[model samples]
Target: MSPLFPALRTADEKEALRFGEHALSYAELAGAAGALAGRLAGAGRVAVWATPTLETAVGVVAALLAGVPAVPLNPKTGERELAHILADSAPSAVLAAPGDLLPPALAALTRIDVVATAGAADLSAAEPDAAEPDDTESPALIVYTSGTTGPPKGAVLPRRAISGTLDALAEVWAWTPDDVLVHALPLFHVHGLILGVLGPLRRGGSVRHLGRFSVEGVARELTAGATMLFGVPTMYHRIAEALDTDRELAKALAGARLLVSGSAALPVHDHRRIAAATGRTVIERYGMTETLMNTSVRVDGEPRPGTVGVPLPDVELRLADESDGIGEIQVRGPNLFSGYLNRPDATAAAFTEDGWFRTGDMASLDADGYVRIVGRKATDLIKSGGYKIGAGEIENALLDHPGVREAAVTGEPDADLGERIVAWVVPADPQSPPTPEELAGHVAAQLSPHKRPRTVRFLEALPRNDMGKIMKRALGNGNG
Candidate 1:
């Protein structure tokens, strides 16, 4: 079997990773990770304090090198959520950067601080036998899902899933060693760690992490030869907002080879704004923790504003029986996860009787196979008065209004309507918000009268997760 990252052995001196002021070449990374892999050789599973740091990257790499399944814990996780993950994964050791202030949740686990060594030569020489697992089916990562429905379940991703997804993306994006990726997304999720960090490494490319996202930071990297930018809608929204007055930022974005958005749908309004300013169209992709990647707008294909493009090579995607062409997205591919760790029933339930994983996302496919995700099946699909409505379309319509800065659409129980659409809106001006009737008229004009919100609730902001996804459950609980 071939190595997941062939560059580690062949291109020893090429720059591999950069986080703020820290950097490591391919050889140096191998040496550093190899040293840690030696110590982790027999470990069952390890937990990584997944900060946007070089050590977190090294720790995960080392665990993969040693054939040990790694669990990445979000640094910002609350005490209860943190404890749940810790107990669920039950890692043998906890990997952290030296001097990292760990929460009480990780106090009991054996701690291993990942430190940078001298060079690749010293560490490589220390363990020539430290090699990646030959079996592609072996578990590589145990990433936990956001427990919106229940306690977070661990999604065990195999080595093949990572390699297959990256290779497919490499082909889709025309990714190469010359391409330098830039982003500041959190490392605990698939978007940042798997694609942002490992994708570059697998392609023999380099990644420049901003540590934290800023308009200035993005401009500096892009102007300094970074070729690609990866971000969620919030980050891109900021970029779109800044491109008007910030000439440097606009120029930097215009110069970028590829601008990609994922984790959540990027509003079409923001998409057009960025394109109008920079002459660059942002690409969107769709995937989840269980499925590394399923669809993406191809670099060589049309850069559609609102649609996530065709399925990757070897992925089979279909809409689960709907006359309107909007249904739950079911996918079957090599990139699919093995199962939810330690939850056999939940794992079994995740897939259909025939084996396709139910993505739990409501979506529609165009004539050309582009995927437009509507919303989550559990929350965003509202059956109101004999019609099925997707909250995402309504939210997009609400966002188009100049008076609305932020918007999330949900459905609440109504005695007459079964479920009535409710719009949670963050007004652009607190002193003068668009009236409920005005916003309803706007949505009705754009889409249909049925899609218009029955009630508009004014809020300072919509509740969001780390990935910038609107938390509708929080809104129902009066937390938003």
Candidate 2:
């Protein structure tokens, strides 16, 4: 269903989002969302598909402003995937292209909201009613995550779910109207929606969102004065590669106000190298779909190499481990989601009897409060011969190797050792694959023998979803 975009209470005149040749003012974006929201105001549930480009970005902001729960989905998806989401969601309608991603026979998608072409819909959607919405807070989104089930589960995020994120960042990472963000990440994920768009937009900053990430395109946008940058490790690796042939572009990226890396673990080598190459640390942060983001490296202080920095404001973190002090991470805060949509059993399983939301991530807290995420609580790690091996740490170490460009480490069952480290990597050059022995040797020197990958396979690129998360399930099942 189409959502009405709300007008920004504090909007900047200079900063505008450029989607292809078309550029929309803050008012226009708000208007589009308002138009969508107008239609969705009565029904109250909508799923949007416009890619991460200009049109979709506007649509999301509008939904939130209208106080309607708008779900952003991967555009590349077909009727099968969309059908599952719509059937489960029971949205009022779907605001999408003529051949929308959703399956037929699902509810919502009425004549009022459905449009003929890709042309921009009017600011007024629905019955053009002027009934002011209540200050009510229910589910604002049904954010689906990378789960075991073939059909993804949606995390129910409320209006208050995103406030703590902005407040926490403000307490540490300074944001202002002068700042302009280069948002190339997908909108389907929490990072792109909450931090990428909402965070900057809330602070009255401009976001130059791209339909898809392109190194040269992003570099050019930065050169044009986009100040903030945030991306996953793979995106940064590509940025680093682009900077090599385009030194000027690298210089441009170095000029940003703040640079951050998240969504997936950012390799330390890539983190430092990108910083050295572009003159920015690209502060690494830790978060998940359940909790928007709890930890991030400081802008002024030393961003500890492996850690995802300290907990954000209102977020309390502690390790559940008794021995090594590294187990599952537990968080308590407003930024956390209410629960899974229509999945009461899952919601009950998500948290302890206490209020704290049980983040599936495994991490260790330091004396200074900095937290380093090791792995997921449920099967994202390998323990071979009594030594724990996290996919993130090994993958980060692998990417540090000059020949390796992208890598994903997963555990395979072994009789002798409960689980052994197995890595699937994408070399910078396909023809010149990094030798398994050489890669293993590099990891062995850096990590313990148990932590070292027992087997390595070279591929063109790692399997990833629209949000840029490495699909380990795909790899484990050989689907990747």
- By TM-score, the best candidate is 1
Query: lDDT for model 2, on a 0 to 1 scale?
Result: 0.71
**Per-residue lDDT of 334 in model 1:** 100
The ten-residue window of minimal lDDT in model 2 covers 1-10
Per-residue lDDT of model 1, residues 150-253, tens digit only: 88999999999999999999999999999999999999999999999999988889999999999999999999999999999999988988888999999999
What does candidate 2's lDDT look like per residue over 1-480, in tens digits? 212222253222444466555566665554455565555555677777746666566666556655678777676666667777777777776666444444454444652233322336453453333333443346677787765655777888876667667768866787776788887777778888778877766766677776678887777878888888878877887776666678887788878878888877777776676767877777888888888878888787686777888878778887775346567888888778888888898889878888778877887678888887877766575677887656787888888898888888888878888787888988878888889988998988887666788788788877787666776777763333
**After superposing candidate 1, which stretches have Cα over 4 Å from the reference?**
117-121, 124-126, 477-480
Residue 296 miss distance in model 2 (angstroms): 1.3
User: What is each predicted model's overall lDDT from 0 to 1?
Assistant: 0.90, 0.71
**TM-scores for candidates 1 onward, in order:** 0.97, 0.88
